[model samples]
Target: MNLLLVVAAVLAYTVSAQQCSTPRVRSEWSQLTQEQKGLYVRAIAALAAKPASNQYANPDIMGWHDFVITHAREAYWAHGNAQFYPYHRAMMWQFEQAMIATGIWPSNMGVPYFDWPAMSQNWWTSDLFTEQYLGNMNSNDPDHCVLTGPFAKGKYQVAFDVDNRRAITSGDTTCLRRNAVQAAGDDATAIANSMNAGSFAQFTSSTSGSYYDTTNYHSTGHFIFGGEGGDMSNASVSPNDPIFWLHHGYVDKYWWRWQNQCEQFLYDYSGTLMSANDPNGNGIDAKASADQYTASWPFKVQQLLNTQGGDPLCYTYSKSAGDIPLAPLTCPPVVKPSVAPTTAPPATATGGAAATSASRQGSQLDDKWLYTALNLLVKQKPLGSWGNAPKTGATAAGGIQAADAGDVVVFGRRDLNETESFNGTLEVASATVQADETITGTIAATIQATATVMATTSAAVSEPIKKEQNAYIETINPDNSTTISYTLSNNTIEIPAGFTVYSVMPISATAINETSGKPKRFFPEIPKLEYVQHAEAPVNVEVGSHPCHLAYPILLPESYIESMGMNYNKYFNAHVRSKMQIDAFNADNCTTMFSPSSMMNFNSL
Candidate 1:
């Protein structure tokens, strides 16, 4: 049979029992009174609270569709025939319940149910399901058409996409039906196989295996449809897919569990995608992208992760006890070195002569030195300037050790005297030292100062005989002649010369006195020097011999300017040739330079 006919046949078979009753319409469901919603809430709660043993203990739990049938049967049994309805009717009733609870009263809810035959003859045909499905797809507004009322309203409508191939609002009925069939098929297989496969332990262990490996829609979508192959060809895929509600219930359950378990998990949920939209049709993303969606059933995912039976979410046929807790995994501790010391070292020689006398014999020094040495060797330094050895009696072999300089220390010090006076002169022990001199010995220098004795002659004691003032005359050096007009006052010297001046010497007193005594101020003993040359200027000289012909300026070769014309001519010729080739190719006058012609030729060859 063709795909559509096959789908029609399946739908017909599925709804055959309730063929006389009018199909429940979501619009009609929205008009139910408040009393109906309360009743629904209670019924659903009671149904949720029912023990698994009361529901799936029979030998017939086979496929996902069958499981769903079994669950509906349980709900029927719990609520009685008056309180329940056929698949479509029950959904309509629930919608009413949700509407009343949400304070929305759609106009169609109060309309009485018309017989299927009568309704089919009316303006609204029994094919309302098909029409609605097709209409929702073409509307390009899945959230508005599919998730119309309270139960599926609010944030829940956000993720719905009319354009999605897998979306309910997408008009691809074939794919949807196929998906439903596959889902129902899988659930049915898992259920039927689990029955013959011994206890719940065997079934759960096998089914739960590798389930968490992927987060793809297919992996999750399978469960969403039902345990096995769900019937997607039906218009009631949303409410008819019994597994959807159960799975979501469990998601809610996990939320409650997370509240008690993962402390950090508590917060406003957020994400890039929204579960629903507002009236203006804008997305409402989650508050936190990492927020987890959990099942709302009485049992948690943690409880279900290792469990196959006994929990509220599991069927009673499951044989395992669900109360046992799983063992938690932990990491190992890290280890570090301890602070202790243990050994001693051999004695070393004392200082040489003139040094304070020190005994080198068997002196009982603490093992502090050994600890200190080990620390210094390891950390590469002493603990402080005062050089802390280990505690007094700590033996090198005892493991008690001093900290190295790099080792952190906690101590304090205060300056006792800031200005205790002491004077000493520094002297060089030896001269012409190639390397830097390292003074090792201690020294103490003494300094004494006295006024010079003045002769007090009896020659009329001439006005206290003040010392004759002395002065010197200096001549400028040849090199320094450029700076002849410089000035010297006190110790400060000034030179206006652009170049740097190295050193200057003072004239001798005897030379100055002789110069002053002579009429022309001549000093014969003094050197007749010009400017002192501090350093010699560098000489620039060319090396190697040049060809005689190349050396003569008059016979020099043509300059670079002459070569320029030749270069330009070569460049212009190349450009002209390229332009000619391009123009020929453009004109289709020649095919050699064109890629299309070349490719054609190559192919032919």
Candidate 2:
């Protein structure tokens, strides 16, 4: 016999004076007076808005769902708390209404009916809500409700007969009350179990089969029920399935109940679930995992569950009919603060201070050399581009440009204002001597590079260039004993050998305020150089006319010289092809202009 047929047969055997209730449209129509009905409605609404991903969709949350379902079933059977039945019934009705309101259900689709026995079977098959129930029941064969009964092997067996009807209409008063108490006990156990298994950590990794992968009804169903399941977009779903809402309402009910039972639970409400990208959909803040609920909402799950018909949280309801309101129920007061403030500073501060001090002291070595090194590092480790190519001999831009060699290029003057006490300088100059002439130039004559200091009071500090004396550079070359010199004036630094210079200006300076006496600072124009072959004239006296070789000094501004330090060739190569294409290359086929071997040769040069 079919499992459904067997369960139906058993259901027919038990008859009650009270009929299964219909859902109420408004709060006043419920059998339980008006107030209890209001509480039920509020609880349902709270469950609808549960944090679908984090604590709710967790396996622990699923366990709670099962526990709640089991208890609700148990309560219905044992004491016929009729009150609890209406809450769930009303919840289902509201959920269906929402589905209709949101157009999730077809227009022609009549309202779904809730057959508790069928629902019980559905829960038994679900991966998210079956663990606890499975432990006590025989799920392999739906015909048998008993795990170890004589009739377990056949359909319409006696095992199903006992469990389906014993608690509901049994004359034994002790058994009837025990059922309700046991149901509550199961609920408590599930909550404790769920609390112990906090936050789902699976979403943090790169695993492909997580619950975040789909947006189908199954996934949505799991989300509402707080169960563990894959994305719902599986191809096997049908159009007229009734299990979706039954499962979702149960899930929602758990959240509602959890809100009431645990103060910590209400404060911890958060949304960290991933959903399909929809522009108008609620955005999931991954960092919100750390945030806790603090705002006072109009209703909370806890107060809704506990309030009676006369209280502000109350509403009336009956299992045979929907909700009725006796008095108007007001929303619950919002909880203010969720997180606790620190009484003392964290221990990491001391460690961080030591690290910072060490770094600053290390940076104080010759600023030019340090700048050059940082420029190289920056070039090799470019995070993003700085826009259009810089023009030659332009004003010094104030942003630092790093090189692949960990060198930094700084451009500008090198003097400090009276308010600031730093005055650092690097001076260089050169003089040429003919082959037969005596070398008669002092070291001071070689000091041809100079940087002037300027101070500014401005609001925009990131404009890229500021008039501060922060860098200097000079170059000198000897060609057949003739010296060629490259120099810089007050606002610029000559670029050294094998360097490319770029300038950045600061947006504005913060040290210069309205009350400060300093004028607004501006960067001076910078000169850039490119090395070209320079040939010396032929000397007629020696042999026929031997060509004299000449070596010209290349003068680059401070910023351009710093660009030579870093090696960014590797980073440039990495982004050229897909990962598969890169993996496909071998020593033979991979010999291209930008290949690893060629890049190494370029770096060496």
Candidate 3:
């Protein structure tokens, strides 16, 4: 009886010690006491000090901030994809575990979140960012390093840019940096509207900031804190920042608000499962596999859907939207028709002089672009090699340009950006042709190319939220050159869901805002080609009715990509396409590029 009584007392004491006093009301920065704040900072710094666990010390693993980037990087999933909410929620939870293990976080404490709107006007001046606190902004540092934050000043050393693979440890031993620049798409009105969005896609897109839809808070935080060399902006080391947890605490609140606020979407859940490291590669996985997409966590996505029921239901935060007001519930539902119209084509015809066909009318290529005519020269054959055309006096433009003695011209030149049809039907009516007798031979020719023009636009356009379907075709030609491309079949930018225009605004005296909605010029003029429309068949002198040679060009353009500084061929499928293209490639299995109800963020942060 005496031993039993003693055991009961110990059990009671242990329970009392571990009672998580409150659910996650993660206090705002101003509410935390000096000790609480310092503990949080030091705890994260302590975790940063330890080498990654041997199990996770792989070269691809970077910093204490591994799981999120790992899934987003190696698994090639998460972020803007439909898994945005659940995946990040789990990521934050995992991060909290690390802090707990560090023995610095107060027992049973909650991670705090920053109220951007409340501090928007004077965020930088707050003591939360002083040399004694999180640290001053990196603006004063010439090397673009964060040297004043509490975690800076030798208080901690952490990894940076681990997503770059080769950078797992390269130059990682440095202070974090912050640019204090306003991330674009963070307007108050936009924020409120996004909060009011009806679907998961809409909500995720808005939060995607300028990179996806029309939201701001989440995006604004990333760029503002991670400008230049700041870890926040760098997806690889974003978690290294002490502020990362607090910032994401608010982001998690956004999800909870969408669900419980008036319970508008209490049981709502709808989105496609995309591939990423899943053995199946890139498509909808079987239910067993799909349910397990919580990155490297022990739990699944469904467990994260309900804050009140998840294993232990650890914490919660204030639902009051604070200074960044919640958007009105009246905002429109997110939708994308398979076919949305683009701008009309230019009227004046030049180059290959493509007849102005009304069927090809859609989005307009920027008029400022020097519309260089596109020329497709196919290698025709007398069995194995080209031997020039029939030398027949064929009429092309001013004069028929002769193919080098061993080549055959299929489609003549024209401004691909302006004249290339979105339908992709550059066809030749007949394969039979009467070329100079010497070049007589039948050849089955299929030359398909999809060209999408991505550039720094005239207006800062923000449409990164829509996760598009995969639109690509990869086929080897006899010449050994591989043609991999993203065909822009139904890539239409509908207003609201597919369009955004904004100008940068001043958030604070020290904060230099860089709004993406504002106009900015892009490089490489024409980044790459995206699509081809089905229309009038291509026309050129058909070679002899022979089927000796098979040739086609997909033209994703590796040369141009390198010239523009994009590591195009990082891997067989290391996606270097536009933000949407990359997302589409990972989501869909190289099929039609249409629309997905969920979000596939490009990690634009």
In terms of TM-score, the best-performing candidate is: 3
**Candidate 3 C-alpha lDDT tens digits along 561-604:** 33111223221121212222322323332232111211122121
Worst ten in a row by lDDT for model 1: 446-455
TM-scores for every candidate against the unseen true structure: 0.18, 0.20, 0.49
Candidate 2, superposed: residue stretches over 4 Å from native = 1-192, 195-239, 271-278, 281-285, 288-605
Q: Model 1 over residues 166-190: C-alpha lDDT tens digits? A: 2344433322222221111111111
- What is each predicted model's overall lDDT from 0 to 1? 0.21, 0.22, 0.38
Q: Write the per-residue lDDT of candidate 2 for residues 1-605, one digit (tens) a residue.
A: 13332222122212211221222222112123344433333333333323221111111111112222222222211111112222333334323333333323332222322222112112233321222211222233222122322112221111111112222232321110110000000111111222221321221111111111111111223222211111111111101012334443433333333344434433333222211011111111222232211111111122223223111122222121111111222233455334333232122212232232221111112232223222222322221111123322211222221122211111122121111111111210111111332222332232222211111111222333322233222222221111112122233222222221211111101111112111121122322222222133222122112121111111112221112111122112221221112122222222432233432322221
| CA RMSD of all predictions | 44.1, 35.1, 25.7
User: Candidate 1 versus the native: TM-score?
Assistant: 0.18
Query: For model 2, what is the alpha-carbon lDDT of residue 325?
Result: 12
Top lDDT model: 3
Candidate that beats the other on TM-score, 1 or 2, i.e. the better one: 2
- Which of the two, 1 or 2, has more lDDT? 2
The global Cα lDDT (0 to 1) of model 1 is 0.21
Select the stronger candidate by lDDT from 2 and 3.
3
